[model samples]
Target: MKPGLLALVCVAFLATLPPVDAFAAPAPSLPEAGYAPLKMTIGGETRCLTADGDETKSWQYVALKACEDGSRLQNWKLKSIGNARYFIFNEYFGEKRYLRTYSKASSIALDSDTSGYSTMRSWEVSNGALNDIRLWNVYSRDIGQWKTLDADPQSQSVGISIPGGTRVDVWQYGIDMPTPQFPVAGTRKILVMATHFSDETSADSAPVRDTVLGVFGTPYYEDRSARNYLMQASGERLTPNMDFLDEVDIGERPDACNASQILSAARDAARHREKNPQDYDYLFVSIRQWRQCPWVGLASVPGNWVLAQGSSAHKFWTWTHEFGHALGFHHARILYGCPPRDGVAQLGGDCTTYNYGKAPTDPMGGGGASMFPVAYQHFAGWLSDADVPWIKHDGTYKLDPLWRRGSAAQGYRIRRSDGSVLFVEFRRPSQPFETWWGASPYVSGVTVYVVNYAPKARSMTSTLVNTTPGSGRSMGDAPLLPNHSLDDTLSGMRLTVTLAHNDGAELKVEKLPK
Candidate 1:
């Protein structure tokens, strides 16, 4: 070989295996000044905290590496509230240096070096931090104006998407409410319920009486622990089982329509199927706030149920509709985030479209005996072909295969006393993307593609997606590993997966995701 050619070969080989530092970045330097122990009471505790570096910014907790060995203080951002009022810290999941032993809404604080633990405040954190240390801006640019909550009233509150770090519990509903605050006025996302109530076998007659705790927010749903409530209208006993639609005890479901009897059944629905936040599909339970109108019944999350005073029967729609919101769905058929067009109409708060199944006839759409109305369609299930465009365009549900493959899927089923509702979710691994907009669009749980995706590999973590850079995310369905959704349940509806492998191989799935 020519001498120059051999030299080039050596250079190429060396380039492929650069110095160890090639993959390493500089460690954040500590401030010249010595640090001290600091302490702040959060919720109501005097924990101890230590910091090694001088605070980079005041009233703003920028990157604060806890004063522990191998901590990622400056690495993780921190917002310092005045006089260290709220040492808002941002720690990702599994970053041992940024470990959290408590839930965000519970009692907790950051360990400061100066005095002790910092004061307890609702410092936000994400499940999968992605090490995205970017700080949260002042205003929250949620999807619709319905999130406005009149602005100023909500200005002082933290604008967030991820539910990690810390959160202020403004309400007192039962277990499995939003697990966080309800924006301003104790209401987050507003929803409108337009449905036809069931009549013959199922009907929730008594209007759900609500005891709103105004400044205290709404009481949690889990606060009530009855096995199930009888639906006074439908005469069905709502069961507790938010795990999956299948666990609904289909065998014992009693079908009937009555006033007091259905009201009693409603109890079963509310208590059933609420999962803890640790579950993968935990995000699916967030409920906004609702209003009551004569012709409309409203529902919101966390645990504040509202019903129009005119007709208790109308509340059935609100029951199901609000439950839909808890799982991240707006009105069916309505064009949202996207501009309105033909077939779509702006209903005071949420948008609506006229393209759904015979909503007046479907039980879920608020249809049944004792009462009669249009039915709702099977619109809130796994992502459908028609829903993919919007899911990818708006990021409601992600198509990133990285998260799909990295984390396991978690499923849940929700129920109210009036009747039970079935659902499935692909939850974020551990703590999901907790950054402002970094969260995958799977807000209302996730719309997993049950068909048409197969990838074979030696288990690798490629740069599948990174949207925080303000770049449009890659467009492609997150690989649906085998038949997760299909095998998990049994229904008459047949599922077909036209899977395509990453290695230029076509595949088909007759199974489900494990």
Candidate 2:
């Protein structure tokens, strides 16, 4: 502790001291830093975007960034800066909203304040010539005006309609799936639950309905079914339409342990999707190793009907409906105007009576009818108009299917419309014999346009049979339901499909009399 030694030590320590901020990287400055304000399509209509010259590459002119409904152009966080750079958003449609950011920066040059958008409209870029990258957001928004968007406010998911007898086979790859290729909306998520079906359910106790995802075995939603349903629904509601995605069935696995396996499968599927350029989307699944107690026999949702150890009918239904969630169809809100029982609105609509009263028609909303066919075929995707035609919950032109998965994800061949061959695998799942006349809003009903075909579906001759209504079991007021089954043959030379609806709608169905 000598004074001279202490002074020497202090000087040495001071010499070794680190510089104040030498090694640290400096934060971006206000002018040099970037900000990401959210842009939203209020009602799936239009979104308003604003940015300053500082943030935009075009520092001289105001930058005009174009955005689509449910489509965001940047993964940005807001940083309050100048007056021209502020954040404001609102929703016009229901509750859902989405944001997307471009992988590359889009340059939008504006001349001035009032001329911001208008001038940008005439803005040009090139090796010197003008480019034809047509977009709607170049010059639309005012300082704080609400932007108008035209993208369809509906979501273009997928739709399904299978028959009770239609066998559930794993879609083998590198093989000819040779399906109808009705353009789908978003990525398709598959949920396999084969072990939960029952043979005795017969078509009798089945519920009446429409084409949609239906479940029969293991009650409505088991751990597998419920988890899959939630994942698909969440993705649909949250993620905007992207290039690729799908859900699939898992082999026999325990319900409780299925979560991890399902997540693993989704990851694998996602990786595989990269090969197809359809890899930029979301996926969900439930792999069943064996029936675990936590997930075994659980309700698909709340009051689902598919129970464990059922028949093929139930199993088929499960696949159909759970897939529906991935496809983007919300459950029928009893309050939305469905038949209410005892004050509680029943989702499955009204039940039809049948078979002496030994059994009642299903009321869960997912179809279970043996006749009338109008029943919601849990196996059917119950496509809504918005889910079809490649529209967002808010409408917009979907070019991904046409540009990316076009030839592979879709194609059309004309076989002289003869009874010999026509009506390829429609990919539509129905109850025994059901046909969808309308488009599902949840599916990409566009993309696939057919010129002509023979009537292998027999829908031309197939009439809706009005069967006796189930007595007390009947939920709908109709004493008769529509008959969907048919076995007939017809042919035609050519057919022109104008447009396809997303709700499993058949665009062109013209055939010659047999």
Candidate 3:
């Protein structure tokens, strides 16, 4: 066994094994870089992907914290690794480590080795929503989900990876992103069909039809109802392109206008009317008889049906509320507990659980006076870029009534270092269709909200940073008057109402120190 003979034997044995290039030379790099000041969310909490305030720890693993848009550590860029794969690199560390997910490992970490890339370090990016995207692990092919790192007392409130169906929405920093707005020429057309109980000989569809026409159609632009406000806000009118048909009696049976028969009655009435494919955007059944108590409105169909009683109980707000669903709007308040907490349930717009409908601010909450929340406006595409301005710097600003568009800021979204947001706006309680304010007369003023943009939390996360503590009913306790302030010392953000007049309110905001 001479040295030369042994070397020749080793070379032959190595040749018998697999080639070094057999696994493929990773993936090709894409030109994606320089995008930053973004936020990563999981289960409605902002992830803290930071280097622990220690600049020397470039080798440290990335973790999730409450979102802080101001932190350079949280900013990232996805450097491509070919085959629809990418390495999510933190901008702060300059490619020192890549965010590494695993096929079997529950936690995500940072890999320091750049030369030897693993499939776990690669990700596939796909659209999550308009101008939003989701990341999938190239190895596991599972979507990225977050689990709290709370078990480690030393760990900041950040998220660690757990693979599942949850997706994160990455937003372009410092812009009031546009909400979903469809073109006006393609506005949805809906037909309103009134129905009567077979036994109720005097019920007529005229009143119901007239109400729908009056509320949703004709006077909407002038009356300043929620519908009118939406029209002014989105520039795209919600004109359901309405049509009214004669009353169709639901057959003379004891159970004739019962819960089971309403939908059928609507179907029959819809068939009885002129069939126009162009007019099929939605179908509304106005039941003329009143016997039920649940007051359940139907919205199972995406662009159809706001079936409600044709009685006196059917108010303008109620009709508008049902239309909200027809227009693809869901309940603004779902999971509810308090500001900065996960909501407990999925109650759409109903505030009975918290305040017993005493001061319902939203039409969905059974209150008529309150304007729609900013989140709803955003979802409904009611807020244009001009309506909501993103504030990354400190400033004293004037806010107009959120009900209508104005020259000043209708609303300002100030991002904190933790990635939580502050929404400041002025609310004119006397705005049209806002009659619920009479119930809590003091609600007209400047309003500030803290927004949690995670899906589970985003629904209930738009809670008011109120100036008053436990003042009115839970629904009425958000708006702040002139000279009042709501401060979040932890986030280093403070909002003060300087002047509140009919024109608008002056607000001074202090963002977190850079």
Query: Candidate 2 on 74-178: residue-level lDDT in tens?
Result: 222322222112121112211121111111113322212232232122211101001111112212221222122122224311111121323211111111111
Which candidate gets the maximum lDDT versus the true structure? 3
What is the RMSD of candidate 3?
A: 17.6
Which prediction has more favorable lDDT, 1 or 3? 3
Candidate 1's TM-score: 0.26
Candidate 2 lDDT trough over 10 residues, lowest sum = 5-14
Candidate order by lDDT, decreasing, is: 3, 2, 1
- In model 1, the runs with Cα more than 4 Å from the true position are 1-121, 125-294, 300-303, 309-317, 323-514
Question: 2 or 3: which has the higher TM-score?
Answer: 3
- Tell me model 1's lDDT, rounded to 2 decimals: 0.22
Alpha-carbon local distance difference test for all models: 0.22, 0.23, 0.49
- Each candidate: RMSD to true structure? 24.0, 24.8, 17.6
lDDT for each residue of candidate 1 in 19-46, tens digit (9 for 90 to 100): 1212111222211222222222234532
